[model samples]
Target chain A: MNSVFWTHLVKDLRIEWRSLDAIVSMLFFAGLVVVLFSLAFDPRAAVSQGIAGGVLCVATMFASVSALNQAWSREIRHQVMDAQRMTPSSGAQLYFAKVLVNFIFVTLVQIALAPFFFVMYNLHIAGPAWVLALILPLGTWALVCNGVFFAALSIRSRNRELLLSLILFPIFIPALLGMVQATTAVLTGDNDPWLWIKMLTGYDIIFTTVSLLLFDVVFHAE
Target chain B: MKKAAFTLFPLITILLMVWGYYQAIYVAPDDALQGYVFRIIYYHVPSASVAFCFFAVSLLGSIGYLAFRRSDPNKAQIADAWALAGAEVGVIFCTVVLTTGPLWGRRAWGIWWTWDARLTTTLVLWLIYMSYLLLRRFAAGPQMQTLAAVLGIFGALDVPIVYMSNRWWRTQHPAPVFGGGEGSGMKDPTMVHALLWNMLAWFCWGMLVLLLRYKVERRHQEYAELEAEEALASAD
Candidate 1:
């Protein structure tokens, strides 16, 4: 299982490395969103400071969706998913690998966008930087876990992109709320970042477990 | 017998609705706080409850569909019909809630909407089910049912989180009027009775809608089966 998982993960990583399709496009989109946000809001205003965290999270969410779509579309396009299913590796293994790859892709895009977000929004992290360090990965993992699952689920649809976004966004509300709140706490030096982080972690665990258990059903349903 | 039962449903529903409305308007005393505007509660609360109930039913149907899909395709077909019916009815009731909520909000809260947890969650719930319906419409082949069932289960899971998030994060939405801990009940017995009657009436109406919608879905499935059979026969 472990070997199968790593092999799948490496396969996805190599594909992305060779094409640079998912990562580059996601980063570019993320950057554009940040720039658009800066243009829309006066960075010097108090409202901008308040909304910076939310805007950054929203941009990341949109970019992650694109990356997820790219990841799954590549599989569907090349018939790689069909090939993977023929392997002895369980659907769970492939799910986890895809989730990990997506998590990494989204997180890298987020990291690339972070500097631009800070510079464009004129944002400063007032809290301990460790708070962000903890929240970023956990938050991204939660988002990608759902993303990868929904991306796969919607892959068979006629309007895959629209269906994926429509289904994914609403289910993502709780996590989005938690991440935005936690990020806000870190940015504004709010006293209770831990509460939001706890919520995000809880959400991450619940969704990851649920999606893993259900992935096989969805994978073979067709 | 089934035809007779179907014929009886509308009569009962109409009677209950008329009685419930009378009780709401004439029997229930004016709310000391919001007065006439609070009457919308009788409609809005019951619609929301029915919506929630239908979604719950849809969840069960989805579970049944998924559980029996492989072993008993017939049972799965019935389950899928139930799920389709429940979701369609649920969405209709949800639309009522969404509409009535804003009207009440505008009159009582002096705003069209607030990002309060319940309102936001309700909106998300509507979107979730709307997505479910869209998926059913657009997704192809035998896998569509299973895929939709999975989404139905996930959407059901979200309701609790949505409710909890609202409870934990206080917003402009008033705290729960029922089951909310501490100081959340009607003072007037007549008002409570009116609310109860309306809730019962709405439940009956919702069930009737579900039954009718289920028949429609069953027939639609049968029609599709016939078409497929005919196509195969002609090809042969």
Candidate 2:
């Protein structure tokens, strides 16, 4: 079971490593968003501090959509998903592997964006750096878990990219709010970062479990 | 008997709506704070409530469809019909709530919109279900129903979380205007009656619309099944 998970993960990683399609596009998109936002607002102003967290989360969310779609669309386009269905390995394993891969990809894009954000926005992290670090993965995990699940669900659709975003963004509001609020607290020197962290953790756990259990239904629905 | 029940529903709805409107405008006293603009509450509050109720129905139908899908295809079809009906009707009422809300807000809050907890949550709820309907429309295939059912369940699950997060976050909109704690709610019995009457009327009208929509969905499903069968026959 564990081997199955690792094999799938490695396969995806290798494909991404060779093509650099999803990661490069996501980074470029995130960079553009940061630049556009910087152009719109003077980073030296008070408003920048208030808007920074939201802008970062929004950029990540939009960029991750393309990455998530690519992750599933490649399998569907190549009939790889059908082949996997014939294998003895559980669908949940494949789901977990894809989710882990997506999480990593999103995290890397975010990491690449972080320095740009700091430079462009003239941002300062007032809270412990550890809080931002911890929040990054937890928040990204929550986003990508839902992203991958919905990507699979919408993979066979004609208008999947639009459909996936339409379905995902609304459901993503709570987690996005949590991440934005927590990041806001961290940047603005607010003391209650834990509240947002707890919310993010809870969001991640509930969504991951639900997505894992229901993935088989999505996979076998045809 | 079924036909009679169907015919009777529209009549009852019309009468209730007429009475409810009269009670709201003439019988119920104007609110001390907002005066006449508060009458919009009669429609706005009930529409929002009915919208939430329809979503609840959609959730139940989605669960039922998924649960019975393998064991009984017929039951699954019924569940799918109900889910479709609930979502369509829910979106309609949600539209009314969203529209009426801003109009009320324009007069009361002096702004057309606010990031108030209730308003934001309602907006999110509307988006989630609208996506559900859109998925059903465009994502054509045998798996569409199953996929839509999963989405329906997930959307419903997100509603409470959306509400909670918005509440914890700051809100610009007013707090619960009705059924809230002390200092909230109406004092006059007639106003209470008008509110309840409008709620009941809207619920009945919503159900009437839901039943009609369910019939349309049933017919659409039947047509699709027939087309598939004809295609298979021609291929053979």
Candidate 3:
């Protein structure tokens, strides 16, 4: 079962590598959004330590949606999901695998954007900056888990994006709130990011559990 | 005897509804804070309560359909009908909740709409049910039924989340507007009689709508079967 899961997981990643379209588009989209934000205000004055966190948080949300759309939507659209269903591993395994892949892809895009943002906005670099590292992977994991479920639900619908957003945005309020606050706290050296950290962990656990229990039904849904 | 019993239900329901409305309008205590506009509570609160109840009904119906292949088709169909009716009525009540809530909000808090957690969660609940109804219409056969049932269960899963998240997280919305586990179920003794009666009224109205829809759907099934038979006879 373990081998089967990893094989399936690796297969998804390789397919993504071959295409490269999703990662390229996501990075481009994130950059464009950041640039748009930059242009909206003077980069130096606009980078209100607080707003930088908000921008990245929103960018992460959009970037994950783009990546998940690429990863899940194609498999669903092509009816390859039926093949996945017949695999030896359980639906739970498949869901986690997809989430892992989505987490990595989205986080990498975030890392890529960090330097561009630093250069453009003249963000003051500070200690270790490595703590900011944990935020992206964990935050994107929660957000993409949500996006994957919605994407799966909306795959065959007439208005996919509209339906996806309807289901996706409302449920994500807590995660977004937590991530933005935590990111700001980290950047500005707030004494403790404990509250935001706990919120993110809670969101991740609740949603990951939900996705595991519910994915089989959603994947098999007509 | 069965026909008589059925008839009695509607008759009693009508009487209860009338009596309930009278109490709600004339008897319930006037809140010093909200004045008469708060009277919307009689209809709005009950509608919202029953709406939650209906979502549960739909969830149960969906579970029953999935678990019991041997159950009577009629039972399943009736359950489906009740579920649909409950959801439709639930949506209406939600609208009332949403509408009257803002009215109360504007009067009390001086804001027409605020991103208060409860308001946001309720809005999400409303949208989920709306999508559920649309999914039901678009789905067909056993597959459609299964899909609706799955969606129904998944959708209802959020109700607990909504209620709890408000409790656990930061929310501008106050404690339960109605039955928040205190104040003796009703704010006033007279209001109790009125609110119960109003609830009975809305429930009956919900039943009437359900039965009417069931009849319409039954006829539709019959018409389809007849059309199939006609096509077969014509072929023969």
Candidate 4:
């Protein structure tokens, strides 16, 4: 099971690395979202921090969704999932792997956006952008788990994107709420954002477990 | 049998709604703090409660689909239909919650909308239910049912987190208005009665809608199958 999981995981990673389409598109989308938000709000750094948290939440949502749609939809569309299914890998392994890949992609997009956001919004990154580095992984985990599950649903549908947002966004509220609150706290020099961090961590753990148990049904639903 | 069940539902719903209104308006006392407008809580709280009911029902239907361990197409279809019904009804109540919330907000907070906890959580709830319906639409068959079931369950799971995120993080949202009076610091009995009666009425209303939606959805599925068979026959 471990070998089977690793082979499929590596295959997916290699495929993503070679094509890089998902990451590129997500990055572009994230940039566009941030630009659009910046233009609309025209917020100075002082007033921007309040809404900046909201903006980052929205941007991260788009980035995560874009990456997830690409990652899951590509597998389903190309019938790559069939290959994974034929392997001896358990659904949990496959689910985690997908989450892993998506986490990386979303985090990279966030990394790229962080600098741009800093300049454009004059937003200061408290604690050298490293003190808050954990937020990316933590926040993206919640997004990716939900996204992977939705992507599985989308793979079987015609209007994949619309279907994804419709099903995923509503449940996505808490994660968005947490990230925004936490990010805002950090940016505003709140000294601690433990409460918000706990919220995300709790979401990640619960949803990850649920997704693992449910992935077999989702992946093989047809 | 289904039609009779369906027919009986609306009659009871109307009767209950009327009684609920009486209980809310005439029976329930006015509050000292917010007066007549607080009456909106009757509708608002009930709609919120019914939304919770819809989510729980949908989760159960989803779990049934997964745990049944049989390939009964009939069971699968019924489960999906019910899940969809719950989602639609859930969305309706979510809308009610959103609508009534702003009205309440305007009265209490002096603003049309606040970034407060209840408002944010309700908005998230609305989005999640809407997404659940969309996922169902996009996917088909047992897999669709399973995918949606996961969503139903997961969506239900998120409700508490969303509700608490604001309070835990100290965001500007209002704390939970109805907390069963267990150290929530909310001690207005009139408000409590209004919340309960209003919730009951909305639950009835939500059920009525769900029953109607379930029947329509089942028929809609039957019609599609019929059309497909007719096409195959004509081709033959």
* Model 3 regions more than 4 Å off: A35-54, A76-79, A117-132, A184-193, B1-17, B69-84, B137-141, B177-187, B210-236
Tens digits of lDDT, candidate 1, A1-222: 589899889999998989899999999988888888778875685677689989888988988888888867887766888887788767999999999988888888888888877777777777887888888888889889999999989989899998899999999888888888888888888667897788888888888999999999999887
Q: Please state the Cα-based DockQ of model 1 relative to the true two-chain complex.
A: 0.82
How well is each residue in A3-62 modelled by candidate 4, as lDDT tens digits? 756765787789888998888898898889889998998998578877887887788887
Order the candidates by DockQ, highest first. 2, 1, 4, 3
Per-residue accuracy of model 1 over B152-205 as CA lDDT, tens digit each: 999988877876776566677766657776777787889899999999999999
Query: Whose DockQ is greatest here?
Result: 2
Residues B23-124 of candidate 3: C-alpha lDDT, one tens digit per residue: 877778786666777677788777777766766766777777655534676676656655666667678767878988888778777898876677777787
Query: Which pairs clash in model 2?
Result: none
For model 4, what TM-score does chain A reach? 0.92
Model 4 lDDT at residue B213? 90
* Fraction of real interface contacts that model 2 preserves: 0.87
**Any idea what lDDT model 3 has?**
0.72
All candidates: TM-score: 0.97, 0.97, 0.81, 0.85
* Inter-residue clash pairs, candidate 3: B20-B197
Give the Cα lDDT of each candidate: 0.88, 0.90, 0.72, 0.77
Give the DockQ (C-alpha) for candidate 4.
Answer: 0.71
Of 3 and 4, the candidate ahead on DockQ is 4
Q: Fnat of each prediction?
A: 0.78, 0.87, 0.09, 0.96
> What is candidate 2's lDDT per residue for A1-222, written digit by digit as tens?
589999999999999999999999999999998888788875675777778998999999999999998988889766888999889878999999999998899999998888878878877777776788888788899899999999999888879888889989999999999999998888887667898899889889999999999999998888
Name the better of 1 and 2 by lDDT. 2
